[model samples]
Target: MLSALQLHSRGWRVSVFDSGSAGRESSWAGGGILSPILPWNYPEAVWQLSRRSLPLYDALAPELAEATGVDPELTASGAMLLDPDQIQAGAAWCAAAGLAAPEIDAILQTRGPSLPGLLLPWIGQIRNPRLGQALRLRLRQLGIALHENTPVTGWLRDGGRVAGVDTAAGEHRGDCVVLAAGAWSGALGALPVAPVRGQMLLLRAAPGRLKRIVLDGGRYLIPRRDGRILVGSTVESAGFDKRVTGAAREELLAFAVGLLGTEAAGQVETQWSGLRPGSADGIPYIGEHPALPGLWVNTGHYRNGLVMAPASAELLADLMEGKPTQLDAAAYRLGAGRL
Candidate 1:
């Protein structure tokens, strides 16, 4: 949506396509964790992107809220990681990567409080459903064409250049085509993307269950302003089956229960799943095809699609406009995995 807004603002006619309702996929389902709760594990480029994007939330959130009449609730609530081993490794990686490691408050130990958690002081989060709602409303205000419930069957190309897409209704022609189709991105004819499913459970937080986001190994407990503490995200290669299974739910429950005290575990309200586009490499595919002409891609964000959305739009729009990009957008190209 930010990409569409950026491009449309540049006087380009932009159109977005989605199989379900717009922004109903992983983009909407995410817990909106920005920056590394364990940022040290990933490459420095991702952190750099968040550093650029994290500031924009303040400006973008209010502007989007005013324009769309929906506040995305972009909050600067920090994240806590309870892995001492990962923290040590993360500090070493930060120094090796030529980045500054955030200061740690080691004195905050409270009579050996459960376990000493490393606090990522610069992280941010957004309410994803609200972000999606606001993005859609903003796009509508801009007169950008939104083709929801319209799945692209294939790409229509002529002489190596992409002309448009072959959809269920008809072909929509464009001088330049940008595929921001989220998780279903790879399977679109020549695009080499596979859908990865994630099962997440949403629980209403009891009073003061958790103040900040808690990362305990595989399970993350994200608390929202409206009292919905989202416990998520099981990474399974179930091939686009966006259905929550009993096994996955039970696993999340067990993990979450271990993290929280006895009473907080009982407040788990609902469970659901959302599919994310995953590549063999965990990095997202976000550049133009090497061979295809007049075409671009912005998919394969893994689970960070929501967090990366704002920055991606700015970068992609810069590429489309033939202007200088902030990051080396070409780094995220579809190399051997070209569809």
Candidate 2:
């Protein structure tokens, strides 16, 4: 939808086709951390797209709320890293990236392990489901065709060049086609993408219980505006199975309770899972296909799709329009050693 929105704004007729209900998959299930959870751990390619995309939400969130009447609550709640070991590297990365150095011991209230933490006060998050809702509404208001539950089975070809998609309804001929199918992109061929299941739990806590996002031991706690704290997630190589497991639930509950104390034990509202488009490395493919002309791709985003959406859309749009891209486009091309 972000890609469609970008293209439509550039005077192009755009249509979005989804195999299932739009935005109900990974986009809806993701904890909307606007920045990479552990920024220093990721590659330069991920940061290139993320740093550019993060700031775009400041203008986008309000635009969507004003236009669609749904506030995709973009909050600058900041992020705290409880792992004391990574503090030095994190601080170094921040300095190199021209960001403010993380303030040590920024979080005052803690009931769990007494570990030192570094806080990046500029970190922001969005209510991803609300963002998805706003994007869908905004797309429809702009007259972009949204074919929800319409699966594109194959490509509509014209001689050697790809033309459009083959849907169950019929062939929807177009000038070009973009495979932005997320984790399912590998099924369409030409991308080394697979489904990696991640399960998350939501807990309804008091509004001021947790002040900001907290990361520890590969898991995170994201506090929402309406007193609902999101506890996530378990990274498992469980293929396409999105069924929430009892073990995952118990594990997440334990983690939440450990951090927020025993009071959080009964705050469990619901548990859900999402299939991220796991690439070999975390960098996503965001350019035209070398084999199929006029067939572009914007998939393989893996865990960072929500964070990288805007800049990924912008990069894809710039490439499609033959404009000079903001970042080095060569790094994200189809045959850029992603496999």
lDDT of each: 0.76, 0.89
Cα-based TM-score, every candidate:
0.91, 0.97
lDDT of 2 by residue, 1-339 (tens): 999999999999999999888899999999998888788899899988999998788889999999999999999898887767887788788888888755555545354446677777778899999999999999999999999989999998899989999997788999989999999998895689999899999999878778899888789999999889999998889888899999999999999998888888888999999999988888898888888888999998888899999999999999999999999998888883664
List, residue by residue over 1-339, the lDDT tens digit for candidate 1.
778888888889889877779878887777788764576666655665666676667789999988878999988676776776786776576577555546545625321565566665556689988998999999988899998898888778877789998898899988888887877777663566678888888887754556677777767888888777888878888886777899988888887777775665677788888888776555666667666777788777776777777777787778777789888865576776434
Q: In candidate 1, which residue ranges exceed 4 Å CA deviation?
A: 92-114, 336-339
Worst 10 residues of 1 by lDDT: 103-112
Q: What's the number of clashes in each of the models?
A: 3, 0
Q: Residue 48, candidate 1: how far off, in angstroms?
A: 2.9
Deviation (Å) of 195 in candidate 2: 0.4
lDDT measured at residue 318 in model 1 versus the true structure, 0 to 100: 84
RMSD of 1: 2.4
